[model samples]
Target: MAAACGLTAAATMLPLVLGGGSGDGARPGGRPLAQAPPAKAPGAVPAKAETCTDPEASLQPSSADGPTIDRIKKAGHLVVGVDQNSFRWGYRDPATGRLDGFDIALVRAIAKNILGSESKVTYRAIPTNQRIEALQEGKVDIVVRTMTVNCERIKQAAFSTAYFQAGQQVLAPKGSPITGYNDTLKGRKVCTATGSTAYDALKAKSYGAVFADTATAQRTVPNQLDCLVKLQLGLVDAVVTDNALAAGQAAQDPAVDLKGDPFTTEYYGVATKLGNDDLVRRINQVLVDYRKGGNESPWMKAYRRWLAADLKGITGPPAPKYR
Candidate 1:
């Protein structure tokens, strides 16, 4: 699961160091955190000439090495952009100060497949809004964070076949009256990460809820974990994020929990820059092998290790689909 002891200490000490440690809405230095200008939410991609219907369908699995593969081999290590705060998916273990989780395991699998060494990787902690930017700028070879595949994103980046399935859900304190993504949110402040699908959902239909942090001096934070912080500090009444991630947040803090069932279906994919067909195909091939072995598959083992405890009922990784 998580680094129990270290996470416990972090839960106790993080708020104290970050700002407000209590639910009284007090911030450090007696000044509220500044709200950054809003980033475009990474919801469904806009319609265009190349609009897609099946974003999960990717290039056929291939072991072939091409330009992107050659470049990565020449570099001798994989540069992966990931989130260091999303527990169970990807996070730096406070106990050992090493990255560990489901996504980290997949990154290591990719590294071992491409570089013949799992340890030969450099992780760059990227925020939600910058996933595509990092890849397009050649800052990272691939992004394995819980990035959802959709029509719009495919236009900007190539993706491997679906690896994990997730959906947006609500997270709130245990005793809160905010039941779910319903009218109960009327007039209540909700928190979501900037550029996240959750923000998009709220923007499309708020149910009388207030999500624009600028109006409340609480703009959305870059990381999903930051939403958990705001929830702890009473800055927002509920948090809307991926249920897979909300499970981790609930595990990290017993005071909060997922408030409702998932509202939409989405798939997680490993994203590479556009035209990185070689790398994308190679990753698809890796996923093909990674999904084998049934119950003993590496994917299932990872799920059991990190996710089963909090997010249950997953039988296996999503079947890979090819274009």
Candidate 2:
């Protein structure tokens, strides 16, 4: 299959960072940190469990400006939290040193709608575990990373309507005995990004895999790319992550490929600090226009340019659901 997510020629040839170098997400010979506290920040009211039946249903789209939008406009730029290590989703181009990918394209679209210039935006690299913290701490105005929309997450953050549909899947070497997400992985070393849904899924049912973070072996990493590194170096037998992201990893290495069908249904969305309904609603509006024009829509165009080859058979973006 053709490379998915527009993996740059340079990205496919990236040298392996063997020593757990900076920004590589490797933590060789290090122990996983203590469990993080709850997703809600101190003094923040948690969302009632009953209110989150449909996490993907968001406020109706509105172009009217609010305090959040006014502040970003006044500052003349939008601040976006993104991932720079995910090959085809939000990675920085090694050749140009500029962020490019499906997520980055959406960030630029939001900036253009808010500030009249896509370049008038600052990108901050947010780790998978810190996406909520960054938003609650006001470190970033919005997070366009491939964040999943879930009831627990909606309790801590506001999400726009679902932008993309993805699911948990396994990625392993070309000829590994590890079948899909089933018993083939029993007793094997499987890697996943810390605080990711994949980690949660594994915790619920791992088929006897040794995936927990330990003092001797750090199975969890700061970013998903680190899992790929571990797989390449024989440290981990398999990697479990969003298939959307796993597709990019497979593009980077011909030896590895997605092993099975996605095991769970999930939706990707734009996230803001809890109660940032204005920003959330505004983002919904941007997405409304982004998903227009059928196959010619910006959402479809992005898929064709960045994700179609590997994540095939998608006709269009997910329809928006309003609360």
lDDT of 2 by residue, 34-106 (tens): 1112122222222222245777899999999998898877777777788888877998787787779999999
Off by over 4 Å in 2: 1-52
Stretch of 10 with least lDDT, candidate 1: 30-39
Error of 1 at 124 (Å): 0.2
Global lDDT of each candidate: 0.78, 0.79
Off by over 4 Å in 1: 1-52
Report each candidate's C-alpha RMSD, comma-separated, in the order given.
10.5, 10.0
Q: What is the lDDT of residue 240 in candidate 2?
A: 91
Q: Model 1, residue 245: what's the lDDT? A: 93
Any idea what lDDT model 1 has? 0.78
Q: What is the lDDT of residue 88 in candidate 2?
A: 75
Q: Write the per-residue lDDT of candidate 1 for residues 1-323, one digit (tens) a residue.
A: 13433463453332212212233312122210011111223343231211457778999999989987887777677778888888899887777777789999999999999989998886777888878877777777899999988877888899999898777788999999987777888998888888787887788778898888785457487777778877877778899988889999899888888875666667789999899898999999999888888899898899899999997777888777787
